[model samples]
Target: MAASSEEFSVNANEAIRISLVQPGPNNRLITKHEFHPKFTYPIVGEAEQIFGYKGLEVELLFAAHDLRPHLQCSYVKKFDTVGTTSALDLNKTFGNFLPPTAFQQGFESEVLDDSKAAEWTPPGVCVKKYTRGGENFEVWAGSLLDMPMRTLVDNIQIFIVFFIEGGQFINLEEVDWTLDRWRVYLTYQKASKTPTPNASPYLFVGYATTYRFYKFQKPPKDHIPISFPPTETITPNTLPSRVRISQFLITPPYQSSGHGSALYQAIYDQVMADPTVLELTVEDPSEEFDKLRDMNDFDNLEPQFKAINLKIDTSPFASMDRGRLKRVPTARLLPLDQLQAIRSKNKIAGRQFARMVEMYLLAQIP
Candidate 1:
C-alpha cells in the first residue's frame, strides 16, 4: 500500500490548475505584517477635555520607528451667523500654530558693508563673524544684563515654541537681568547682498542661552572670614566658576547646515578660554542634542586620550592580601590620576567626561 501511494501523484494539468489560484488580501500569506505601527494618545485635562481650546481635540501621534513625534489637533466650531458647525484641520488653519515671526520671510534684510562689519569686534565683544556660503553670518555674545542683548533675545524667543515640543514663550521682561548669570548667543545672517537704504541689515537665524553659576569651594580652616555689609546691588562679576548650556535652537531653514555645530563650538571655545570656568556642563538635554554633544566631545578628546595611551589594564593582578583581592578595584584597573588631569584641562563635566573615557578605553582594546 505504501508503494502504491507513493506512485499516485497529481497530473501536470491538475498541478497547473492549483498553481493558478492566488491568495486573497485577507490571507495570512498575502498580507503584509508589521511588528509595531503608529498610534495616538488623546490629551485630556481635568474636565476630560483639551485645555484652553473649546470644541477642540488634540492627540499625540507616536511611532516606534519615527525619530520625531507629532501632535494631531482638530476642532469643530459652530458659527452663529452660519448656524452650522464644520470640522477644521488645526495644522492648515493655524499654519503649524507658529508665530509669523518664526518664518524667514518675516525677517528684515541687511547688507554687510565694510563700515558695518567693523562695528562687530572680537574678544570681549562679538566673538567671531565670517562669510559662509555667500552669506554674512555673525555670532554676538553678551551677558543677559546688557540691554541690547536682552532686546534681541526678546524678539526671537517666540521661535522656541515652534522648534521645541511643549515649549512656552519666555517673558524676558519678567526676568531679573540684574543677576548677571544668564548669557545669550545670537546668530544673524545677512538677508541679502543688497538691501534698501533704510532696511535692517541682518536677519535672526538662531540663539542659545547659557547660565553661569557659582562653584562652591571649601575654605581653609586657617583663613579668617571677612564680613561685609550687603549693598543695594552686587556687580555681575563676583563669581562665575561653572557654565551650563541651557537652551539651544536653530531655525528650521538653517538646521542641518552646520550652523548649530558652529554655534556650539563657538560657545565651547568661549568657555574654554575663560580661566575661571572649571567645568562645562549642559542642562537636561534631549536625545538628539545629546548625540550631537557626544560626537563633538568625542572628536575633541579622542586624540588627547590616545596620546596618553589610555587603555584598560587587563593584565593579571599583582599578588595582594586576600581581603584586598576579593573586591574589584576600578581605579586600579584604569589610570584615574591621568584621566582626572585631562578632564580638568578640558573643563568637561564629570559624567560626560567619564562616558568619553569609557569609549576611548573600549576603542583601545582591539
Candidate 2:
C-alpha cells in the first residue's frame, strides 16, 4: 500500500529535494517544473469503488519551488459508461479549474512555410537580433494599438500568472488606444539550421509591458498661464518623459538563457533613442528583477562614470584643519554636478542612481 501511494505521489519528494539545492553557476533559482500524473482516484471511497462507476482523475501539473512546494492540478473525469471507455475532454472538464499557465490546448505549434511563417512574427517592429550560447533570438517592439499585438497578448498573458507571483491579466478591449502610452516588447527564439519540420520557426520565449507618462517639466518663471478657447487646439507633442515597465516575464524553459537581459537592454536602447524620455523605471520590481536591473545598469554606467573620473572626494579629511573640523560636509565631499550629469545621461531614476553611485564610491574608498 505504501509503495502504491509512493508511485501515485508524482515524485513530490524529488521536487522538494531539487528545490532545496542551490542554484547553478548562473545563480538562477529553478522555480517551476512540469510533472506527469501516474494514478487516478476518486474524491471519496476506495479507488476500485470509483472505477466501478463515474470517477475523477486528478493530475498534478506543476510544482512551484518553495519551502514546501505548492502543486497546481488538473482534473479529468470518466465521461463514458463503466464498460465502455471514451476520450477525455481535458479542457471542457478542467479548463477553469486548472491554472491559466497550464492551459496550452489551443496553442499547438502551427506549421508554415517561409513566406507564411513571417506572419507569425511578433506584432512589434523588429528591433534587433543577436546570438547567445549559439542560440539566435529576435526582439520586437510595438504599441498595444497593433491588432496582432492585442491578439497575441490575449493568448500569452495567461502565462503571466505562472511566471509572476500575484500577476493579473489585463483587459485588452477596455484599453484606450488613443492614449498611445502602452508598449510591448517580445523575444522569440529563431529556429536553428536543422529545424524540426512543422514546428514554428520562431518560438515565443518572453515579453514585457511598459507605460509612458508625461514628465513634469517646470514652466518658466516669466511664463503666464492662459486658458485656451474651446476652438483652439493644443498640439502638445505629449512627449513621454517617464517610461515604467509594468510586467516582465520569461518562460520557465527559457529562463537563465540571457533572454531577460536581452529584452531589457533592447527596451533600454529604445528609451535612450527617444529624446523625450527622461528616465526608465520599473513598477514594483521583484527581488530577482531588482538584481537583474542592478547588474545591467551597473555594467552600462560603470564605463561612462569612469571615463568622467567620477569618484568620492576624501580630500576633506586629508586637510583636517581646526576651522574645517566642525563637521564633515557630506554633500560637498562628492561631485554632485558630475553625478547629476551622469544620472541624466544614463536616464536612471534618482533613488536607483544614488544606490549605484554609492556602490561605485564604496569600491573606490577601499
Candidate 3:
C-alpha cells in the first residue's frame, strides 16, 4: 500500500485572504474555441479524494535572492466559447473573455505610509511565474527596486512572512492582475476629501475587481432555469469541460533553483497517486522550452513526462484515461539578435520603452 500523503494549508491564524473580484474596464477579454470550461471537470476525483481528477496541480518554492525563477509546466486549461461544440453560455455563465493586452496599461501606485518605502519593502520583485483565472500575469524585479540588484534573500523572507502573517496579500494587487480573485483593493488614499471625480490626484495602486472563471462540482438545479439546459442531465464525460492549470506559478526568487523541479515533482507524485487523471495534454510546443527537457529539467519529477503537439492527437494512448491528453500551443520566442534589430529600428527612446514593455510582459522565467 502507498503511504498516505498529508495535505497542506495556510495557517488559519494568519489573515491572508483569498477572495474574488469583478472585472474592470482596463482589462482585456478574448474568446477561445475548442477549449473546455474547468468547473465541469473535478481534479481531485470526488469529495475527500486525495488528488484531483481533471484540473491543475500547483506547487511553489523559494530560492535565492533572484526572486524570479524559470517556470516549467506540461499543461493548462483553456476556457472560452465555441461556435456550437462545447459551448459555454456567455452572459448567463461567464460574463466576457478578456484579451491578454488589456491590462498592459500601467497604473501609478502610492505608498500608504512611509514604512512602505524601499528600505522597508524591496521594490520590483521579479515575477518568475504567475497564473490565475487563465491570465498569464508577470512582473519584473527591475520594477521592485529603484536600483537593480538590491534585493536580498533575507528581505524576501521578511516580506513573505509579513504577507503570510498579515492580511496584506492584497498588497500583491499592486502588480498582479489575479488579485481580482479577492474583492480587495490596494490603492493610495488621497488627502483631499473633496478630490475631483476621476481626477489624477491619487494613484490607483490596485482595483477591487477582476475577471475570472470558476469550476463547480455540479451545476445547481435551482439556478438552472427552463431556458437553460440542466447541467446534471449532461453526463460527466459529455459535460462541457477541459482540464487547466487554474493557478500555476513558480514562487519568486525561487525559479531555476531546485524549487521549480521540487514543486513539479510534488505535483507529479500527487497525480500519479490518484487514478482519475487521463492522458495529460500540452498545447503548442516550443523549441526553446523543449531544450529544458534535454537538461533532465523534469526527470524524476513525474512518472510520464511527454511533449507533443496537435500532430499527435490521433495517436493511441497509454495513459489516456488519467495522464495523456492535449495541451494549448506555446508562443514562439524570437531570436535575441532579431529582437535587438527591431528594438534599435525605432528612435532610442522608443526602443527603450519597447524593451521595458517586452521585459515586463515576457520576462517571466517559467
Stretches off by above 4 angstroms in model 1 are 1-124, 130-136, 166-170, 195-197, 218-236, 316-326
| TM-score per candidate, chains pooled | 0.61, 0.67, 0.20
Q: State the lDDT of candidate 2 residue by residue for 195-314, as single tens digits.
A: 323223465667899877766655689977575233212222355468889899876667887888989999999999888888999988988888889989999988877987887667
Overall lDDT per candidate, in order of appearance: 0.55, 0.60, 0.25
Which run of 10 residues does model 2 get worst, by summed lDDT? 13-22
Model 1 clash count equals: 1
* Model 3 per-residue lDDT tens digits across residues 1-366: 432222221122121111111112243211111111122112222232222111322221111112221111111442332233232222222111111221232211111111222222223332233343343322222212223222222122223222221212213315343222211111222223212222222211111111122222444866754475442231232233222211122322223544333333333333234343222212222342233322332232112112111112233444356443443222222234433443333111233334343443343335
Candidate achieving the largest lDDT: 2
1 against 2, candidate with superior TM-score: 2
Candidate 1 TM-score over all chains jointly? 0.61
From the highest lDDT down, the ranking of the candidates is: 2, 1, 3
Ordered from best to worst TM-score, the candidate numbers read 2, 1, 3
lDDT of 2 at 73: 30
